[model samples]
Target: MNHTTFETPVVSRARTVERLVAGQPTSDGAGVKLTRVLTNTLQRRLDPFLMLDAFGSDNPGDYIAGFPDHPHRGFETITYMIAGRMRHRDSAGHEGLLSNGGVQWMTAGRGVIHSELPEQEEGRMEGFQLWLNLPAKDKMRDPWYRDIPSGEIPEFTRDGVQVRVIAGASHGVPGAVQRDQTEPLYLDLHLEPGARFEQTLDPALNAFVYVYRGGLSIGDTAVPVQRMALLANGGDTQGIVLQAGEQPTRALLIAGRPLNEPIAQYGPFVMNTRDQLMQAVEDFQNGKLA
Candidate 1:
């Protein structure tokens, strides 16, 4: 595991932010067709966390054709379900079901083969899967998995806003999902119209907010859907002020201390050095780690 201390400071004050430029959608030929919305692959707004895929389908035909077994290494894949259910099976002898508001956090350290299939017979399905990179020292470690049930997550109301701590802290609540690095925070925040929500964050951390469901205002700026707003680091202040619009709004706020290391990536693997990346490819090809 990485043992480096975070060099950034806590954010004290942030400006009402502007929106991230529009990004194009790309296709991933997993068993079920997947489209990446606000991902680093398309928009390099967020590093370390590389991609975010929001997949959904109401017809059984769209979801029933699930992802078959595939190999992954050098990174983590976190799946958060908002609706329907999914069945996960991996080569590590791990299998489970993830329902609405549940999470499946898988660390493909050295390597792992896994598949994700829908378990619901009917109704619309919606969820998001995010890809996070592992540092060089921890890349070859043993694979691990965390299955967080919906009820296991912490939820609370501040003023009139509802906050869900999925993988980080918010409003004095921390997430249940554990990470090798302690510098990151992930939150799912929902707010009613005419509400105000404010939370403190480490200024040393790199942060970005993605507007997923509804319109929101950071200070005085309005953020629309499918766009990201980058937050300014606080020099001595404690947090940012969030003001909800007249209508309800939802957004994802993610922050992590920057790795500040060179990145060499090929396909699904990311490494600090090209030599290590080549060895990873060979290991996968020779079936030594797959």
Candidate 2:
């Protein structure tokens, strides 16, 4: 892992916690138990970010079947593996094994068929899959994929807090992945007891924090494990202040610039209009989606 110090930004008006959300328990992709944190309903509220699913389980039955072949279009999928092993195969001829602390980023531009299956029989499988939408102009471009290993990610430590820059810039360090359409910022933070951290934000971006382990607080709101705090935007809110409680904590802070464009989605296909979505469905059913 690489380490670098950074000059902390000043937070004149720290953003407050808009609301705390408990993840809805759900099973997906052949009965893989997981929590659907960011659902379809919040798509407009969290524009450019379509969905966020957090999956973790120790039982082989929970994730063994994995995700069979599927099709996706008009978006990108960022799968961050926190533990266990999984293999990815796609119609774009992309293949990779995702282990602990790795990230698999795939752009289903135009469209692509893919499958993700666990390589482990037991142990623990934990990770998150975040769907990021693309602009209309780039939606039908060539497909792309990348498997970022654990060692390739960048991180920094300060005052008992560890920050992983997954996407966008953090402090003075740029993340492993960047996008101009959304300008998404994704960070995994691990904090020791009583630790505090801060980060600056643009007022135009929408953001949220998901606590996966231990507990933390944002502006008097107690965000327990498995909860997400939707950060308030606009006005004088320019940054965020996070304080861990008596126990160590781990969380993902995600923010992104809104596209402010029309959104039409059907199952896995997301497009800018209803006609486009229908076209995607026809393409998939007519054996031409990939």
- Total clashing pairs for each candidate: 9, 0
Which candidate leads in lDDT?
A: 2
Q: At residue 2, what lDDT does model 2 achieve?
A: 68
What RMSD does each model have against the real structure?
A: 5.2, 0.9
lDDT, candidate 1, 113-135, per-residue tens: 88888887889788788887777
TM per model?
0.87, 0.98
Model 1 regions lying over 4 Å from their true place: 1-12, 31-33, 41-45, 180-182, 234-237
Q: Which candidate achieves the best TM-score against the true structure?
A: 2
Write out the backbone clash pairs for model 1: 8-204, 9-203, 9-204, 10-202, 10-203, 11-203, 12-234, 12-237, 12-238
lDDT (10s digit) by residue, model 2, range 249-288: 9999999999998899999899999999999999999989
